[model samples]
Target: MAGVLTGVVGALLTLLLHGAQHVVFGAGGHSFAQEVRLASPPRRLIGMTVAGAVIGLGWWQLRVRMRVIRVRDALGDPPVRLPLRSTTLDAIAQIIAVGAGASLGREGAPRQVAAAVAEVLCARLGLDDRHRRLLLGAAAGAGLAAVYNAPVAGVLFAAEVVLGTLDYIAVCAAALMSCIAVVVAWPVVGRDAVYHLGAHATAPNVWVWVVLAGPVCTVAGIGFNRLMEAARRGGPSRAIHLLPLRITAAMAAVGLVAMTLPGVTGNGKSVLEALVGRGGLPAGVLFALLVAKPLLTAACLRGGLTGGLITPSMATGGALGALVALGLGHDQGGLSMVVCAMVGAAAMLATTQHAPIMAGAFMLEVSQAPPTLWLPVALSVAGAWATPRLATGLKQL
Candidate 1:
């Protein structure tokens, strides 16, 4: 039952996002939210600010009626009954924000919606806390799988990260639900690789460069988290807890930044796709985006807009990798760049989410890289995971 509901909602969210993009940007096909852009800065600024304000207002109202519980909260904590009405509202708000180019990912909305469905069903079925929690994790992961078309990664994310431990039953349930969700979603959203990077060969020449990219991705991931924390801390005080003011200010800042560095806006999926298709970008441009995207993302999220950072992080990590490849003068046909992209994205995602296995699976699945590259990518993720632990320990001493 949870699997069916998750699949249905996931498919609907996919269609809704694509439809919104079509209407807003006059785009012909399924387009990433970031690709739906206005031609002029002034228009984009207005669109972003108003969209942020509306999202803020909607969330403020929803909070008054019922506190929205995050998927992470249900993963490790007591099973709190999720209210359907508030959950729906939160999903709608996220859709609107991303559809309007608010610099956020659309995946989070569907995950929350799926969790709500599971919660409602589990509560009525009189399931115990453990069962309810597991189902919620499974549904959330299934939703992610539906969106990204990554069933294995989704199962791992649920079983390994969300549940924190995996048993035979847990693994079976997660994998089953994720596969079902993807199957249901495939008709509405064609099974397309998120980023089609032709084909990747193991770049022996770039192996050292990929290794070097591991630490760079680690630093960037840590810095991204810190910026987000700082902005989160800085926001409420500045706005006196006023949601509209907070969102407006933060989104306005994003808009102004977008005026010059337009690449910094949106989830960065389309931008990443373009980079892959075109092989590589200028190192200077990649560097600027690498630095600015985290700051902009922090601003939007910290200012009270609800969205996921995973896609944005992936995009930024890919760009960072391309930049490194540029320095190595190995950016040909984007093969080397794509290799670096996989490594950096895996490292950053593993560090940020604390799910190295999921990170490796996701990067490989989405990039469609040759199996030979997976070991290097996994090793890079391990380094990324270890770096922070060592730093924190040294700091504690």
Candidate 2:
């Protein structure tokens, strides 16, 4: 009962923080995207290069002079925490990256931010063992909810991925926090849904396509998961001696490539939006993007990457699936043919995250794409199955 109470409180906090983030992103996204577009290609490239350099330089100097633990490392040890300065800075930098087109998600920022804030509270409150971790989880959930404006999704993610289980107090606190965050963010972000889906086609449900899509998604999901692991940073676990140079160099490379395929850069929301509306891409262009996005993201985190895998991978998978469908020659997927490519994208994303509900919800929000997409559903399921198996096999190998 006590745990349940705390959980509810945590949930509310999660909701509140997530809501706050959504407002921030919504108010700023359009202008930010436009700014990127206005900048000369060279200028955009330079901006990316310079930002990466600064980030890298900071890393190096900080590590050499004092211990600098990124939020990613902070999370490695359970019951771990980071200073608010580091956490907030990461949130700001990452959002700027996404705002400026970094092909990553803004959602991760709140998680780190919330975690650090919760730790501060825990220390001041002198929370006990269970309470301390619970606070962290609740804070994370709150942050996610604030960004997504979906308390349930945040709750599930925190319980499933972060805390690894549900508890009474956590559920309560999270619920409360989620509510608070949303309430606070309402004015700034507005009550509009993230991605508006206009009108959806109910379904003459294509079983044949649905069945095939599942397997295809499975393959895609497995491929993506492997890519992430392969891209995992290679270096000492603790702070490296020369962190800045490494990150700056990686950023420079990513910037050069991103100029060619902006789709491959940033949190990928804009690209996905453009694709959904335009209903197709030059296969060659998309193919290049799919390859570049993952590889660049891989490079970005080589040793000290701080962000979430779910969003970037989802966008990349979608692009790959879309490209595949494009090759199949399906145009808008009109009433009959439907947009097979977009279907593939959504299905592939669903598979990789193993969060079909979240994937479905997110895609629905982001693309305003058709619903009751049976084929896409099947594919996402297939990908989820394959991703774990592949990961397991890779581990064995």
Residue 270's lDDT within candidate 1 is 63
Assess candidate 2 and give its lDDT.
0.58
Which runs of model 1 end up more than 4 angstroms from their true locations? 28-30, 199-202, 234-241, 388-397
> What C-alpha lDDT, on a 0 to 100 scale, does residue 315 get in candidate 1?
77
TM-score for every candidate vs. truth? 0.90, 0.77
**In candidate 2, what are the lDDT values of residues 8-59, reduced to their tens digit?**
3334433443333233233333434444455556765776667666655655
Q: For model 1, what is the C-alpha lDDT against the true structure?
A: 0.75
Reference-based lDDT, each prediction: 0.75, 0.58
